[model samples]
Target: MRTTGGQLFMLVVINAALLAVGAMISGGTYLSPFNLQSMAGQLPEIGFLAIGVMLAMCAGNGGIDLSGIALANLSGVASAIIVGSFLSSTDNETAFSIAFIAVALLTGLIGGTFNGLLISRLNITPILCTLGTQMLFTGIAVVLSDGRAVAVGSPELLSQIGNGLFLGVPISFLIFVSAAGLIAALLKFTPFGLWLMLMGTNPKAATFAGFPKARVLIATYATSGLLAGLAGVIIAARNVNVKWDYGTSYLLIAILIAVMAGVRPEGGYGRVICVVMATIALQLMSSLLNFGGLSNFVRDFAWGALLLTFLAVGRYNLVGLLTPNKSRKLV
Candidate 1:
């Protein structure tokens, strides 16, 4: 019986502990402004993907967006190729950057709509459908880029969006926060949010209540894809290029963040704020690992372990195991 507030509180405590430990171990480097900025700059790509995963999970029926990173890569690659055809990133940096972002988002929307059609119209399983599309998206990206990274050529506006800071916070981080806030408001105040939650909680009841299941499902995944597209824009800006294999471990990390945020895989429960906090926590942990000079392999192992641990905790109600049960004597 973990309430959202309780979970959020727990995350706050954990984040504080991680920060303190990292600072102590890194001899203050971990708490330095430069290090904090670096972490902020890197957070949005995975944060957006985690948000997409949260949305899909909230839609229930084993909902997940496994194709998120693939879609993101595809978005970037497709945008690079399409935008490069007409506008040069170096000469038309402003217009080129804007067009690149627009195209990336559009690509993501189309890919997501395709996924929604497969799951809702064709009655495909979410996991399998997404897995298949993941491969499809990756294949398309590879073909588009010819198995090479497509350079975005240092557009000033894109660079500013990806790497610049406003009021001592990374612009990308601010964008992520703003997007998360909007989604939070959507879940709180909209009929679609209510429908999504109800549908996940009890599909039969939702159907009886005249909920539009197929439409909701399609919308849910479409929104997820859009987020993935945004992630693509951020990725291209940060790395200055797009490739089919970028962020190979991001899918696992995104899933890990959602689960750590207490987003139930069975759906019907999630909070954008919680997901945000979870993203920061993971970022802190990653920064701490970097300070410790741990290898990427070790970090991956830790992520896998944490994912499994959280899944088990969710499945088995591990907290209840530690609480003593009181028995009443029969009169």
Candidate 2:
């Protein structure tokens, strides 16, 4: 397995290479400030979802959150409807925006908590549990919105969060970086982090050691849900509306990001900074595809290929296979 530092270095190299190629191919359009800002603004929603996937993968027991994007869309749709019922964005823009954000976050928390409960309390497989909830969330959102996009009227604060900038950096991107930093800190400095790692590494050992296994699992999924909630807010801000089926391909892309970051599928390991770097690299690649005038279908095909490549590398220890073993002597 590659160390987190190795993963970071590899991602940095990939990003630099992509930038150079994009500049050459696009005659500098790809390197322009406008394009860079556009990529930065667009990546946060997927970045948030990728981080959530990372958390779920780190919890072990075939853990994975398939419901992240679904829950995110549901968060936006539910918050818009709930907030719109009692407040008008036209008459109370600021308050309505604040309430919408608050409700979205709260809904995400509740939805995640429900998932955690099912998995931890009932001992349901994480994959199956989240898959079920994914459909459940999507169905609820569709029913509530009646298959229509719920418009979140342009409120000052919300619009700024989605499209505004601070110190020449996008506010949405800044929020994502801040959240990643906090998650990194939590993982590095807290007992919860230790418990999660240990639990994933050796569930029986962790249980015998008296760690609160169920609690850690619940917390892990809950944090993932919170991140999904935040992503929902960003989505609504960027599109100025929420729908039941927004970002249909995001779940797969998010999973690809997590896997590329070297998060272990069977659990026990993940790194936030690595995930962030991987997200940037993938975003650069996606932008490069756009510069090349490739169709969306081609972009999807490339992403799927990259995902399968990484999965093969991890599954077969392809890196280890290629590296000469110092301990082995040529006979």
Candidate 3:
């Protein structure tokens, strides 16, 4: 069985249980369509970051991208500056919108590539490397924006991507689902996927087997950066402003989502589907807290506690506790 199967099941069960509890506490308003839509709409931004974290963790060598939310902020800020400059001419709305998305994606790719080069070539520790880049990205964003939020004037297309609904579903959520599906296919049906897992499982053995370790590492991180960039676009669209400090708790939340999804910190294993499930579950839990009239402080504390708990369990491979005793013996 997949390593994430147990966690995924647990998340589903927990999500249902939380919804039941929330409904009881809120006179059934918690299960209303409006609240559900709000919760679904909020999942994509952090979902993208969680996927990026999963990529880094799957790459091994104590790999992690601490700079994901920072790069996302930078991407949005850069895109907003460029697009806002051209908005005076309404005739170029299409061009400006396209340029906006392109800029965000480019920023993400470039930031990711920089991290990849340093880690893959300079042999820098992934944690320290990303930690430095995180500050650098935030610093650059602050400098560019003068330490203020850049207001985003909504272009119709960008607005649609961010807030439009289709068949009772959010467009942003659809984009996230499509991105997740593509990533899952990449990991399941590609040679690069095999090489990545092998490299993460044992870098030395992969090197002996003639894997292009540097190239793989660069590509892995580059993909992660692109995801962050896309997340920036979605965030700017939804919030109508791009601020360096938006979603200040996102960094920790993304890591928590990835860990809860059962992504191995030691590398070589993660499931995109599991990450998606975990994202929804966490969002539901957060929504539940909101329904209970809990403060943001309480939410943050809860998230911290959950992150620590999952980290300890994963570190010890205690996830097996979620499996059935009979299944364990068979395995």
RMSD of each: 3.4, 2.7, 2.0
Candidate 2 TM-score, C-alpha based: 0.95
lDDT of 2 by residue, 118-203 (tens): 99999999999999999999999999999999989889999999999999899999999999999999998999998988788888
Give the TM-score (vs. native) of candidate 1. Answer: 0.95
Model 2 spans > 4 angstroms off: 316-331
Question: Candidate 3 clashing pairs?
Answer: none
Candidate lDDT scores, in order, read: 0.91, 0.91, 0.89
Q: What residue runs in model 3 are displaced by over 4 Å at the alpha carbon?
A: 89-91, 315-318, 325-331
Lowest summed lDDT window (length 10), candidate 3:
322-331
Task: Quote the RMSD, in angstroms, for model 2.
Answer: 2.7
lDDT of 1: 0.91
Per-residue lDDT of candidate 3, residues 1-331 (tens digit): 3445677677788788888888999898888988877888899999999999999999998999999999999999988887678663146667777888999999999999999999999999999999999999999999999999998767778888888899988999999999999999999899888888888889899999999999989998999999999999999889878999988899999999999998888889899999999999899899888877899999999999999998887765565666754234212
